[model samples]
Target: MMPAEDLDAEYPEDDWLSLSGIQHFSFCKRQWALIHVEQLWDENYLTAAGHIEHQRVDDYSESELRGDVLSIRGMRVFSRHLGITGICDVVEFHRSSRGISIQGREGLWEVFPIEYKHGTAKTIDADRLQLCAEAMCLEEMMVCSIPEAALFYHKTRRREVVELDDSLRDTVRADFQQMHQLLSRGSTPSAKPSKACDACSLRNLCLPELMNKKSVSNYIEMRLHEFVTDD
Candidate 1:
């Protein structure tokens, strides 16, 4: 088992990964590499809507105190051990007995990261892993233990709490290591079509249908032969 402190050690900034890509990596490794490694992106309706929603949350310029909870919007976070960096939508510092002390703060506060999603919760653990990654980063930064965090879904208008357990953390560590390896190789994985592909923003670019076909050249040759035979 990798020690928590070992994951906190800093790496070169140039090689830092995006914490947001955790969901993409969990959903599909090829999709993550295509966007993060190859620098390719195609925004569809769902993605466009999600971007807008996040923009609204990120645009807030100030943090505020609401009763015992101090809400910080658009918090920038990074973890050297994970070699990932990204912005959190909202991080609430709630007053608690078993919390860490903040500089110049009056009371002990526990950190709670809240992530915004444009859709309802899915059976897959992509969003949960993403939220857990943020909590991990916060844990490293603030030197506090965050047992759980919440995910707010726009479609459902509900917040779901996720517990950051040992199994989840181990999966996150392994996924990030695989992601780094994939980056080093600098090669996109072959397209493997699944039910999830239909909702992917890169469907057209991925060409899942053609992926199963013999070859692009063969497809073109067959089409040309049919055209010639008709004439």
Candidate 2:
């Protein structure tokens, strides 16, 4: 395993990956590479709606203190060990008997990161893994133990708590390693069509049907012929 401090020396600052892409990469490697690697993106209803929701959360001007809890919005976070950087929607520092002390603050405070999502909780752990990644970054930056975090879903308007367990942390680290390897190779993997493709914004550009066909070359040739004949 690569040590945390050695990451900056190993990887250049320009090569740092976006922490949000972990969820995309976890969903589909091809999608991740298409967006982050090839720089292709198309916003469908879901993604556009998601952007709007995130904008609302990010537009808050200043941190607010609600009694013992200090709610900080749009908190920037990065982990050199993971080679990823991104912003959290909100991170609430709650006063606790056994917690880390903040500068100029009288009481000890426990950090709790909250991720805002446009959709409801999924059966899979994609959202959970993303939240776990954020929590890991927080732990690395603050040098404290963050045992859990929360995910706020727009559809449900509720927060789902996620425990930062060993297994989840292991998964986050392993996924980031895989992402680094994929980015280094700079080769987008072939499309693997599934029911999930229907929901993907890049389905049209990916051309799953044509790519999955037995004769991809023939399909391209036929399309070219049609274009030429039409002109």
Candidate 3:
């Protein structure tokens, strides 16, 4: 087992962010800042569809019992240490012979975190990173080490195993800390135009076109002012 401090030091800049926040941060930092920091929200068709899907999952009354294990649905989790909160699509808890222990590390408690994605698998790592963060939160809250997690894509009807390794954990941690720092500073960074911008919910409000205009304006100002002379 790796030491916690050593694990933390391995990623000197990694700060844990909430599992849900990962997707937001990846989608668009400005969107994340406007929503999470400024507490703004608007419903579009995409968001509406997503809300319907999440509402189904958030309805935790769908747990099933088979033999000694119970499959829970739509469980919520939060970490004050990480300074973020989010909900898990599902959490499976098995009936363990060993009881929960504080100091005792040896026990049989199984925890499986399954995150439900509304669409097909993405080309980005954000989805998997979010799931990994969820696993880390579960480990911290349950006092057990979760070695792995899963992401269930509704479109693909499949699950992908997510190893709660140091790299991903460090990423989540880093993003969380960075987000806090951003919020504390009370200023949004310049728009970083990416292909993901096409699907962002706040594209209109963010107006990358306008930001690009400012960039051009600054460039032109610098070039034009370079030859200016005072009389």
Candidate 4:
């Protein structure tokens, strides 16, 4: 694992990956590699809706202060240790005597990051990992400990609180480390298609079914055989 202080010298700015890609990497490594390393993307309804939601959250002009809480939307953050960067959907700083001091703010403020998702919560831990990654970055940046965070799902209109346990943090770190390794090799992992593939925006682009074929000729021959059998 790269230490926070040595990350600059080790990973450097050029090696930094997208912090948001943690969710993708967690869900499917091949998907993350395709998008991040190969620079490929395809937008379906899911991705399109996510973009719309992200736009609203990224409206930097939408910040508000209510009571003792200051909510900043689309705040940019990065983790040197993890070699990742991204924009937080919303980070609420609550007035707390034990929190870190923010410029132009009267008292110290405890940081709480909330990630907004277009769809409702799922059985997968991708969303939680992403939120935890954001919180980890905030912790490093603010020099304060954040024990928990929240995920707001648009579909269910639910705010799910996630505990930043040691296990989750360990996974987040290990995933990034593995990402950096894959990126250095410039190799994309094989596709592991499952039920999740049905909802993947890059289904067509990835062509998971054809990924395991030894060669294009073999794939063509296989397709021809299938066609002949159907006839």
In order, the Cα lDDT scores of the candidates are 0.90, 0.88, 0.72, 0.90
Q: What TM-score number comes out for model 4?
A: 0.88
> Stretches of candidate 1 above 4 Å error?
1-9, 216-231
Give the per-residue lDDT digits (tens) of candidate 4, residues 172-227: 98889889989999989989879899999999988998756578888799999999
lDDT of 2 by residue, 178-210 (tens): 788888888788898888999999998887776
Model 1 residue 62 distance off true place after TM-score fit, in angstroms:
4.8
When summed lDDT is taken over every stretch of 10 residues in candidate 1, the lowest stretch is 1-10
**Regions of model 2 farther than 4 Å from truth:** 1-10, 60-62, 216-231
Model 4 whole-model lDDT (C-alpha atoms): 0.90
Better of 3 and 4 by lDDT: 4
Which residue pairs come into collision in candidate 1?
7-81
Please give the TM-score that candidate 1 achieves against the real structure: 0.89
Candidate number that wins on TM-score, 2 or 3: 2
- For this target, which candidate reaches the highest TM-score against the unseen true structure? 1
Prediction 3 global C-alpha lDDT: 0.72
In angstroms, the error of model 2 at 110 is 0.1
Q: What is the per-residue lDDT of model 1 for residues 56-116, given as tens digits with 9 covering 90 to 100?
A: 8876576789899999899999988888899999999999998999998898999999999
Clashes of each: 1, 0, 5, 0
Q: Each model's TM-score, in the order given?
A: 0.89, 0.88, 0.80, 0.88
Residue 102 alpha-carbon offset, candidate 2, angstroms = 1.9
Best by lDDT: 4
